[model samples]
Target chain A: MKRNLAQVVLSTVALLIVLSAFLPDTDGGFSGIVKSADSYFPIWFSIIAVFAFVLGASSLIGSHVRKIKDRETDWQYSVVTVLSFAIVLIVGLAKLGGASGLEGDVSDPASVLGRIFSSVLSPLHATLFSLLAFYMASAAFRSFRIRSLETTVLLVSASIIIIGRLPFASKLFSFLPDALQWLRPDKLSLWMLLVPNTAGQRAVLITVSLGVIAVALKYILGMSRDMFGGQK
Target chain B: MSSDSLLLLITLVVIAAAMLRHRDRKSEVDCIPEIEVAVRKAAELNRPAYFIPGSRDIDNIQTISALSMLKVVARYCAEYDVELIIPVSKSMVMERAREVCNAAYEEAGFSDRWSSSQVSYTTDDPLGFVAHVDGMIARAKPAVCFMFGFFAGESLLLAESSYNVAEVTIAGTAVPSQIPFFVASCDTTLIGEEFFAASAMLSGNQEDIAMLQGLDAGKQLAIGIILAVVVLSYLTLIFKPEMYESFLTIVDNLLHGGGR
Candidate 1:
């Protein structure tokens, strides 16, 4: 009974806030509340978000510590996690290598934090993210077969885009008139991205919007319990 | 209202009428009990629910939608004591998700049942994220997988792995390219606009439904504007080329503030 009442009150308050944000100036009195709420939302969100991180970090650290204490399997991973965490924390906190150029400061490049981030962490992070290019290429190679009509169109479009973007393709197709010039792989590629692509994107946006609304309604009305472990 | 506005209004009514008529076909599984039964079967078989928030940062709309849905999952899971394993790539997203999941547990009055172990984050590497999630599916063997978000190439790998594992996967995303892979590998897939609608549908707020109705209005406005432009251009080409010349001028001046 208490929880249900609380839910009712919270839901009502949330609905009011949403309405005030969207419905525009209904009455004169609402303007102040709307303006103040807008101003407070970001600050509140930031505060909540900062605390959330603290909670997550604590949870992460706590779990690892427990594992290490219990001598859980492959406990060396926890040490690595803690060491990496400390390295990043020290680097960011000390503000190493910042060009702001505050001289003779402990937070300067003279510190170990500065050296680790500048010499190791930054490069490692970049290297990890950069591996996406190779992975993307590999994934595309495996998945982009001409298995269906859609796949065929995708392959052709991708090929045109690739060829058209090259200078040689433009030079080879230069004999065509300006209006008819788009027949070149590059121009056709540009046309594909700019026109049919945008239209298709809009269509998708419409369809997705309909689906999301339906799902959200199901959730809000308690018709769906996947969130509560599919409970009644 | 002007003729343009009138025409747009008419189109919207038609679209709304069509949507209402078509709502029954919205889901393959009509009864709530069936959905519950499916979820139960997955649980009984120890299938993992593959939860993906897309390949973007926490701020992305698709990611937000995913997180919102995950909140629902957390609530239900805690109530029924179903374990959820989320393997996310982005640290910021992990932090936000932890908050959302925790809040959901609190809302469901099952905070004690919720644990950080239920939701985890992998490296910021997309492939690494996929690997970790796949590992969870193997170890935990969740019954259902819910993937909602933006995805690039890795979408197929995740979905196909889940399919091979025989887990029932429900996927939705705003990206068109990822839709096909999800459709092929997952049982039910929400694509494009439906992806957006799924979030609001889960919310079950009347105003959101109205706002969705507003989107159809927005679409109708686009079509009307397109038709007007075409008709005006044709008329100018045949009867008065000079008059058609001013049409572009008016639109440019009005739309772009004459670039002054």
Candidate 2:
């Protein structure tokens, strides 16, 4: 009975939200009521989200603590995690450094929280982000292998696009004859991106949009029970 | 009504009709072979399987789709007695994931095997979360990794890291920019709409299949309209040049809800 009630509430809210998007906005009438409700819904969502952040923070701490307690593999990392989390939380809450008070900004440049974010977290973020370049290079090497006709086509197209985007692509092919000038890397790359690439992208977008609509409809109609932990 | 609203209404009507038609009919869904293979491989290797539900929070549709797929993946893991690890960026996702996984385990009669630790909350910072996951993947060396959700620049990073350690890496995302990265790095990739369709296809539920059919029908309708407009525009430009401007105006108004 509780599940039924929850489903009913969810479905009604979902349906109303969908309907509200289609309804016109006016100063008075049914559309006005919907417009008002739609406006307030986001504020409610933000309130709930604030509470969710607390849940997430607790979950993070709990998981790390459990790992430390159980002596799980790489438990040493959990110690670092907990220590960093505590330091950051305390420093931010106490508003340490630079205009220290309740009115002070936690992220003020001179604040300890600000220093941690800039000095420690920033570098760590940059290090992880920098690894992407190397990973992309390795991934590209593997993907460019000519194992089949499809891969061969991919290899050729990728090479053209890469070379075409170079600053001197047109000049690199300037020695070619007039007729062959059309084969300039820059021109070819532009055609590849603007024509075939755009067409393929549009097709994917359209299909994906339809799929999204289907999924949203399924939820609004209460057909997707799996998401709510019910059997399909 | 606006053009956007009209299109949505049409889609809703078509889906409703399809649902009614397939209400009593049982339909077959061609399941992705990688899902079972990945779970079985983990079981055989006695290693955990990692499922990343994406970097986005729970509000995104892609994340919701990813969670739906998680239920199925968790069930398989439970049945095979393999540990399923899920690292989430959002707290709500963590909560929802725990619930879905527990329910899946219960349904599989392995309720005792379920644990909240399986669904951990990493940082909400995108790169920070990626760093955490990368370290986890490197350390645990899971047999198989499944990444399904919304992703940005970190897509290739995660896929490549998984590819190095795992025997098989399967990924899916609706993000167009990230699709090429998954295609290049993962053993199996579900592109665009396929990711959204996966859970329903895996379930093989009659209503789900009906919804998919409705989606396909809507696509056909969209294609027909596009083709008609293209042909009509060309005809007007060639045979009735003076009316071409008016034709474009009409098309724009019809498509964009202009002149409101």
Candidate 3:
């Protein structure tokens, strides 16, 4: 009984959203409802997300507590995790430090939370994100191995692009004949990026957008509700 | 209905009809072999299968796609009794994920075995999620990892880390920019539309595959129309230059809100 009710509500809400997407916006009463739903649902999602944030914090804390209690291997890591979570939560919630006296946007540079974000979170994110270059290089090593024509082309394109984008490439190619200098790394990279690369990206984007549309259709029709724990 | 919505509705109807008409036929999805192999390997190794539904929230299309893909993963894992580790970046996804996993298990007559611990809400931060998954890969050492949904720069970061741990890695996403990274790092990479096709085929429902086939037909038609327009546009530029201007204007108008 509970399952059936859940399915009904799920399908009904989904169908409404789908219908609302197609509804024309006007001053009429029906359009008003659609517009309101379109406006209001995201607000509800935000509210739910805020509550879910609390739920997630609790889960993380619980896991760390379990680890600390059980004296799990390298449990000190758990202590740090829990401490960091607590500190950030408290500092942000209480608006401790920086711009605490401000009427709005208390997370100004003066607040401890704001400073931590700038000093700690920002750096950590940047450091972890910087791992992309290393990962890219590693991936390139495998991808650029000239086992086939495709890899050879890829390697050449990548090398040209890399060299072209570098600060020294223009100077490096300055010795070339003025006419032939157009084949310099920068020009070649620009042409490649503007023409072939842009075209390829556009194709991918279109294909992916169409795929998303089909998926959205399935979702709207409720044919894919098995994922929602509804009938298969 | 809006014009775009009407077109979509028509496409769905066409796809549904095709699905019903061709229910007996098999649709070729290249990822079938790898998905089957990965599922089997995870089951055999008695290791968990991890499904990361990208870093995006539920508002993103890729997350919705990823969640649908997870239903298949959940069902397969439940049947084999191999643990499925669903590490979601968003808590909302975790909530829905629990319901999905429960349903999958219950459908498999394993209602008593439904557990939400296998599915976790790790963190909302993108890189933080990556860091957590990296740790999970090193420690838990899941046999196979399915990275699906929308990904950005973190795609390679997670994939490379998973490469060091997992036996097989299958990644599917709508993000074209991330496809090259996945292709280089993962064993099997489903690029763009292939991801959607794979998701459809995973249902093992002929109707679903047929619907995908129908969409493929529509896609081909769109391509044909685009090609025809391109050829005609160039021809007009060479042979009928005056007509070319008007043609481009018509095309521009249609593209902008005129057609709608």
TM-score ranking from best candidate downward: 2, 3, 1
DockQ of model 3, rounded to 2 decimals: 0.54
Q: When superposed on Cα atoms, how far off is each prediction in RMSD?
A: 7.4, 2.2, 3.7
Report the lDDT tens digits of candidate 2 across residue range B62-119: 9988988898899999999999999998888999999989888998999999998888
In model 2, residue pairs whose N, Cα or C atoms come closer than 3 Å (at least 3 residues apart or on different chains), thus clashing, are none
In the range B143-242, model 3's lDDT, one tens digit per residue, is 9999999999889999999988999999998898899999899988889988888777776665566658666765775687579889989999999998
Q: For candidate 1, lDDT tens digit of each residue in B1-260?
A: 33333443454455455445444443331222322444566667755455778877654567867876677666666666666677776667777777778887888898887776766655655765676566556655567777889898778767766665655778888887788678656767877766665555554444334445544655665567668878877988799886877987776564444664
Provide the DockQ value for model 1: 0.18
Error of 1 at A200 (Å): 2.6
Per-prediction TM-score, chain B alone: 0.73, 0.92, 0.83
lDDT of 1: 0.64
lDDT of each: 0.64, 0.87, 0.80
Question: Which whole-number lDDT from 0 to 100 does residue B88 have in model 2?
Answer: 90
Q: In model 3 chain A, which range of ten residues has the least summed lDDT?
A: A219-228
Could you give me the TM-score of model 2 versus the true structure? 0.94
